[model samples]
Target: MTTTPARRRALVVRGGWDGHKPVEATDMFVPFLEDSGFDVRIEDSNAVYADREEMDRTDLIVQCVTMSEISPEALAGLIGAVERGTGLAGWHGGIADSYRNSSDYLQLIGGQFVTHPARHPDQREGGEADNFLCYTVDVTDLGRTHEIMSGVEDFTLRTEQYWVLTDDLNDVLATTTHPVQPYHPWHRPVTTPAVWTRAWGKGRVFVATPGHSLPVLRDTSVRTIIERGMLWASRTASE
Candidate 1:
């Protein structure tokens, strides 16, 4: 008799601000997760966090909620689940920008989105420059050997470069530098993590800061990193 492998269960909780296009963003990745052998369940409401039984059975949680308040009961359930080994992964403001009022949530995530300095648009008519800045993402030496970042190399990206407030516990995989432009107050370039991973209790946490827009998320390199990061966080190998 042949033995069947147990399907990994994933719960994607989306919806907070429509600006993040949480529904559309979650739609983009659901198929990938399904193809990766996960039995995926999606909830447009954060209320799902209150279901301790469901949370306990879940193997992974992919959250796309941005700037929303999670109820105390639900928050406790989610935190307890992750602490007990349910993996968590998210990109951009979904994880970092959510739950601004909860210090415990911020500590669990290991970072928070502070700001993205806007670039000055050229006064010249049709000059082609806007707040979106172009920068390079360089993989760190440690990242070169990590499963999530192994094949990814230094690449240039034109998008919102996030200035995040991070903790020392993160295992940084890649980084980008923010140049001192006239639009910003800083006199010197500020370097920040573009991709990183950390452990929360027995669960793994993964974050990437480049997915502000659909096009950015669709970028080949960005997509690859997120896909790999998700698998790594879930403690699964791609099929």
Candidate 2:
């Protein structure tokens, strides 16, 4: 007799800063995950992370919480789950800037958002639009051949260019440079990782720094990359 395979479980943990539109952003991918054969669940708090039973069975986690506090227990649970091979994936401040206070969390993702420098004093006061500027996302030599970046060429985007603090452990796929402006404090232009992945224990982690807003996330290239990233970071993905 033929039997069907068990569906993978995907847990979406979202909610922190609404400006990131955590709910809306995650909602965009829920249907896609379901169609991909995942049994999806959405939780608005980090409490779900501490549920060992659910976490142990989770095949993937898509988190969009930004600049929030995570309890010690919840943080530990999350670390344990990932160390045990539950895939983790996210974009922008959602994952990078999520917990400013947890070093352990930072260690898991391998990167953090320092800032998205504004070009002008006037722009700083105007909001996210003020930080919006034209910039190019250059795919690295390795990225050109990577599954997540395959067929995606160097592309330019008009949005907030993130200045991140990342380590050498990541397998960086794409990068963007923040040019020194007269109004900015930096002496020389600096480049930061825009897309990257990390292998932790048996788990896979994927992060993209470009999804600052829905418009940015909706960009054809950006959307495709993130979709591919989620799949690549899932537990079932081939190593």
Give the poorly placed runs of model 2, Cα more than 4 Å off: 122-125, 237-239
Name the weakest run of 10 consecutive residues (lDDT summed) in model 1: 122-131
How far is 113's C-alpha from truth in model 1 (Å)?
A: 0.4
Against the reference, the lDDT scores of all candidates come to 0.86, 0.92
Which residue segments of model 1 deviate by more than 4 Å? Answer: 121-130, 235-239
Clash counts for all predictions: 0, 0
Q: Which candidate's lDDT is highest?
A: 2
lDDT of 2: 0.92
- Which candidate gets the maximum TM-score versus the true structure? 2
lDDT of 1 at 137: 91
lDDT of 2 by residue, 1-239 (tens): 99887789999999999999999999999999999889999999998999999999999999999999999999999999998999999999999999999999999999999988776786566666888889999999989999999999999999888888989989999999988889888899999999999998889999999998998989999999999999888898342
Q: How accurate is candidate 1 locally (lDDT)?
A: 0.86
